[model samples]
Target: MTGRHILVVDDEPDIRSLVQEILQDEGYSVATAEGGEAARKARRVRRPDLILLDIWMEDVDGITLLREWSENGGLPCPVVMISGHGTVETAVEATRLGAYDFIEKPISLAKLLLTVERAFESERLQRENVDLREHAQPIIEPQGKSPVMAQLREQAQKLAQHNSWVLISGEAGAGKGTFSRYIHDQSTRREGPFVEIAVGSMSAENSAAELFGAEDGETVNYGRLEQANGGTLCIGDIADMDLQTQARLLSVFQTHSFTRLGGSEDVEVDLRVIATTQRNLEDEVAAGRFRDDLFYHLNVVPLHIPPLRDHADDVHELLDYYIDNMVTHERLSYRHFTVAAQNRLRNYGWPGNIRELKNLVQRLLILGSGEEIEVAEVEQAISTQSVSGEPTAQIVPYDLPLREAREKFEHDYLLHQLMEVGGSVGKLAKRVGMERTHLYRKLRALGIDHKKGIE
Candidate 1:
């Protein structure tokens, strides 16, 4: 894991030097600025994980600088205020302006270190809480009692001990993200952020800025690379990343450093990367769509997650898990799957894998009112879905907010319909009950390829 970067901004040269040395000794990357102008320049060069700003500065006072940062770009990171003679009003104002903590100078090294640690911890907790609320799903650790799942989990745990970039290959909805998160949670840097980015979902023009960050004068946007500095960065559908972004990522893997977009100074990052792809990356490289050099870099440790059909014995457990999860998280009524229903699902080929199973369970609970889900109900549902041209199993995140849930459903419905109709936009529009032009507009709005279907 990478050490946290700390910036010490003080008017007194001696104080700046002392703080820098102290933080560096404590396993933090330290940068120092003698005044506000220098501090602004330093921040423009690279975003710090934490900033220690002295209340009194030469050119610009710390309070003014703090307000500027908070107003302009929003404080990129936590800021701690330092003053020789701190007043109650100053402390209150600093706190109100989003200072993590206010410390009186003639500072104790122990107190300073403790405060910095607390600030980072608090930030991590806040981020986690927000993620939890947004997801609203239970944090399950890939539940299954089957030998295949057990072996996979064991292998992942062992691999997590090493600090190597990992490439996870699996079918779409095969739980690649779940396995990636499992590795991160079990790894040494579990406390650090687990940042994930879906490369294919981003446009080529914006991928660079999103991954490498962008700096425009006083405004700065920290990217996934910087956000995952001390932890794991999980890149989903990495094979779809544009060549330019792939080159930049490859450079970062080689040098462990990269400059942000529109920024001159290099920002160093230490992070374990876990990339996933549903497509054959080797084929992508062979076709000149993906960079071979980048493939070689990311393929240091490759792990494949088998489709649900390959692990039939785990189907029962997965069904039970999702049933319970939906009842608890989605506030759906409890319903037990019948023995025959379980047997049928176990024998069936689950093309969509775990994600498909999860969605199936949620759909059953939402649409079925009986206390028990019977084999007939399961068969009817499967048959209906198949006739509708949807996958045998499809994932719909019902736990998402209402607007997001509707969008998800619409995106999936249209994609599945388009695929079923062999990518004919006119047929799809008629099937979905939308005008052809409106369907085109909707496809474009949803970032789907009208003729090619979802990409």
Candidate 2:
């Protein structure tokens, strides 16, 4: 923390020396500039942590220099405008021109030190946000506008306004996954990577490989948590992560750092963790499957996303939105659902939620004839239950039978949980009945290695 760089911009040599001595005694690295051009050049070259600018310069006045810095948009350091002759109006102008704070000259050592510290802290936060943005991926788009859907959007937007950990709950088939994306998109950290992981998708053995990220064939790999640094990490399926894995994860969340399995040296990440699950976390915690402390931490901002069946009024808008997207993507003629078809869709229980709905619409657009989709077509589609209606294929009992069935089951279950949980293994293992270590062993045996889903 020592040797923090400070740039003192002042035409008066006496003032600059006094300030430099004071700051250097306080363990800061001080640089002096006599004029606006020199200050700008120093800023470009060294990019000091903070700048103390004298408002009454002989050539270009401090306020003028401040405005120039603002206009250029490359002012790397936070500027604290200092002056002996500056008035209230000058201070205000300096502030408006992007000065961090105004400091009156004949400066008190205490006041000046406090203001400088505040400026440095502000600069640090801004830099962290920039680094986070540079590493993050773009937010996924969310579309819809029915009253209920509108309310959900509003809720998601409100939640994104803060930096708290969010726990999104919804039954399977609900739009929790989509809502997670919407929240991240609306957040200030939107530019950061939205590294999503389904907690239940990887077995305890593979969970390490999947979430923390292990290298190929004993090489170095970046974990999901590390990759998501400075952005949002959406962990899906809170219920599947086993106790041991959850404990390890809890440690990471507590410390904000983690080391890959079979690796030395810890990696740090700053992220807004948004997790989703269909199962109840309280229930999982009570059942001794999830760590209670972890639950409390994750559940700080709980959001219950209503299932589509409960928000029937929003069905038509969703239908229209998906239809339009399909038409545009496929370069096909425009299409709309008939009134009767719309009614049938609304009445039907969408157990699979928004994803199921989107898939259905895409299927209809691909298979249906004519410009208008009819009630009969929708009825046929839903009745066939073509998407979620069918049960997942059961894994064949492997020949070894040495935990093969359980291993296969774990593999399939982990993948499903990962998909449903959105890449949160801690949540996933809690959902399934097993320890994370056991799950990992199964994952290794089954060979399940995947990355973020490509949208």
Question: How close is every model to the real structure, measured as TM-score?
Answer: 0.82, 0.55
lDDT for each residue of candidate 2 in 60-144, tens digit (9 for 90 to 100)? 7778777766765445468898888778788677777778887887888899899998887786677557633432222255555
- Compared with the true structure, the alpha-carbon lDDT of candidate 2 equals 0.72
CA RMSD of each candidate after superposition: 8.7, 15.2
Task: Evaluate candidate 2 by giving its C-alpha RMSD to the native, one decimal.
Answer: 15.2
lDDT of 1 by residue, 405-434 (tens): 787778877876665444568768767889
Model 2 alpha-carbon drift over 4 Å, by segment: 1-147, 214-219, 386-455
- Per-model clash counts, in order, read 0, 46
